[model samples]
Target: MGYAQVNGVRLYYEVSGSGRPLVLLHGGFGSTESFAALRPALLARRRLVAVDLPGHGRTADADRPLRYETMADDVAALVGQLDLGETDLLGYSLGGAVALRLAIQHPRLLRRLVLVSTPFRRRGWYPAVLAAMAAQDERTGERMRGTPAHETYARIAPRPQDWPRLWARSGELMRREYDWSAEVAALTVPTLLVFADADSIPVGHAAEFFGLLGGGHRDGGWDGADRPASRLAVLPGLTHYDILDAPALPAAVLPFLTHPVREPT
Candidate 1:
């Protein structure tokens, strides 16, 4: 576990185990520790490269606003710095969006892509969730002071007092509008979209996103020959907040990473 100077911020990353490199991107307000629960199981099969995004965990914030595209570039830079050629990318929530950006913008850098609990468009979030995001402001930080997210930030962040700034900047980033349908449709690498049965994102969007990746367009013939390279899995009895660390997460995800998809006929 160490820091690397990438895209102007000293990004924190931790590497473990051995095999094909798998980069783990945590959700908003979370750090590498976010995957602590699944690390052991995942490490057994693949080398894990977990990271802390700008302003999260031990990584300090940059002067520029935290945008998915910029963070994606940082991740790409990190990957280059580490000489992790053609690694798999897996991200949860906020990280999911960043991973999507990386896959869309830096296509050649990834072998496989996994996005969890993230939507391609801002409108994909439930109305209430969007409303809550819109209401984020100075007061929002104080309201979150004692919550687990705040506690985690306070505990491990280089500047714990920057929680309010992080919240405000993140709020600004989320408030912006974005749609990546064309980009998702243009992706060439194998992809997987994972979501909870009941997540902040609409269930229909999951199918829609998968469809954009050339999935759900036709029936798989005998021996599943017609399946698209992309896959989707919605785990039961989970929610967006805790789905990342659930046992079912890696159980559903690891096989997709290990098993190669057959070509469509």
Candidate 2:
């Protein structure tokens, strides 16, 4: 692992395997270690560039709050600092939103995009999930102690005491309203949207998101010439919380990343 000074923060990242770069971003309150379960398979086929986002894991918190746009900018800068060109980028949950922002805001930086268990609109999430997100604060962080997330944070964070502060900032970011439907429709990347059959976002929203990507429309002809560059997969027997680590995650994504990019028709 090494640190890269970008966007006024020392970002920590780990590089493993060897081949085309595949940058992986973990979820909120999570470090690069969040992808441990998927690492073996991922590293086998491509170089894995895993990063710890601000206020989480080894990366220290900056003075600014955690907004997707800023975080995306940080990530885009990191890619430039690392000299990675048109790489495949995959992000889970909070990371997924960042990946989406990066793809939309820095379209030239990415070759293929995978957003796992992310919603284009805040309201796409279940009402209970939104309530829980809004309720997150320092107390929520304290309550999370003794859990796997806390254990990892305590082991890898620069200042473990900042855990509560991280939660507070994350909660603030989450509560803010955002609707990126129009932005999603305009994306030119060869994107893949992955979600659990049972997820925080309603299943209908998954189809709607795919539709916005020019998918789920008319059937492709026998030659499959009419298919959109974007794809969507709803993995079976998984939930938003666990799908990140599921073997199915890599199984579904590796093909998309390795295949030649399909230009938008």
Candidate 3:
């Protein structure tokens, strides 16, 4: 566990196990602890570099707002600082957005990308989820007191008093408008899109996201030789909130990261 000075912010990250590195990013309001339950299986086969994104966990928020693009740049800088060369990148929720941007904006740094519960566009989230994000403000922190997100922040943040600010900034970032279909369609890195059957976004949107990666448009031939380089997995019996804790997360991830690409005969 250590800190890397990158993009004008001190980013905290923890490295565990041993093998090829897989940078793990957590959802908004979450920390490295977000994947605590899911890391064991992954650790056995791959090194886990779990990052505490800016304004989350040990890292404090900077003067700037918490925009996904800026956060992506921060992560890219962290990769450069660590000299990780080409490595796998995985992000959940907010971290997923950052991971998406980095893979699009700095593809050279990554060998593969895994995005869990991520939406390509803002409208990809259900209307109710959008309303919840839009409702967040400084006062939201008070309402969130004692909740897991709040409790974790209070326990580890450099300044627990900054919860309200973090809440507001995260809300602001989420509420902003965005659509990256063009960029997604242009992606070259092998990608995996994971979502729950009952995710924050519709299953159809998940299909849409996979489509952007050139998946699901055709049937995989016998032996799966006719599929796109990218893949999708919609795990059963889960939701956006609890998907991280599900063992199925690492279960779906390991094969994608470890399996070699097969060319059509």
Candidate 4:
């Protein structure tokens, strides 16, 4: 475990393996520990930096509400602090959103981008769950019981006490809207979009996001010329929650991270 003080926030991060740097950003309700299963596989080929975003794991909470753009700035500051120039980034769900923002605001800092199960638009369910949890309500948890978020929380969250605060922080972050489609369309780094076949976010939505990637033709209204080199892969038989358990998940991602970026055909 390691800690870096960035913008008055003590960010908790873990490092493993060696080679080109690869930062892992976990989803909401998840900390650096969430990447444990895939870390070893990735570590073999590159250095892995896994961090707990604010309000998760060992990172201290912010004095104000959490926003995705703010979180992206925090990541940008951390990368500069660590002196990791043009490193690869792998972000899951909420983390993916932050990664997209970073790619837009600070494109020079990233060499490649990987997004897992992230939606282009903020979903209503996320805020609804957050509002309920903020009021100390259990209904959202009850509703999420058999869902991917619940299963993911069961695996990554440290304890019961840790959940509410994280949920509250996530709520604050969700309140801030982002133009993900536009930001992603403007990205210049190589990108790999991964989604589970049975993802709760809907395959159509994921496809919509993929279609936005400016690769020769812009299908989602953004300039295709500004689109970065990209690829999209959907894991078969995997649910939003079970994607982490997919044997081919890490394998599918590793090559994309290590390979050189290709020009749009």
Best by lDDT: 2
| Cα lDDT of model 3 by residue, 1-265, tens digit | 9999888899999989988899999999999999989888898998889999999999988888888898899999988887888999999999999999999889889889999999999999999999999988999977888998889999999999999888898888888999999999998899989999999999999999999888888888998878889899999999999999998998899999999854212
Output the better candidate (1/4) by lDDT: 1
lDDT of 4 at 245: 59
Q: Each candidate: what lDDT?
A: 0.92, 0.93, 0.91, 0.74
lDDT of 4 by residue, 1-265 (tens): 6778887778888878889999899887677877878887888899988888887766767676777777888888989988888899989987988888888888899888898888777651245443553454234445456555556555554454445555556655666555567776666678888988877567777767777875435452454445447878889988767777577899799878776666555
Q: Alpha-carbon error at 202 in model 3, in Å?
A: 0.1
Q: What is the lDDT of residue 239 in candidate 1?
A: 96
> Which segments of candidate 3 are over 4 A away from where they belong?
262-265
Better of 3 and 4 by lDDT: 3
At residue 249, candidate 3 shows an lDDT of: 90
Model 4 stretches astray by more than 4 angstroms: 123-162, 175-177, 215-228
Can you rank all candidates by TM-score, best first? 2, 1, 3, 4
Error of 3 at 131 (Å): 1.0
TM-score of 2: 0.98
TM-scores of the candidates are 0.98, 0.98, 0.97, 0.81
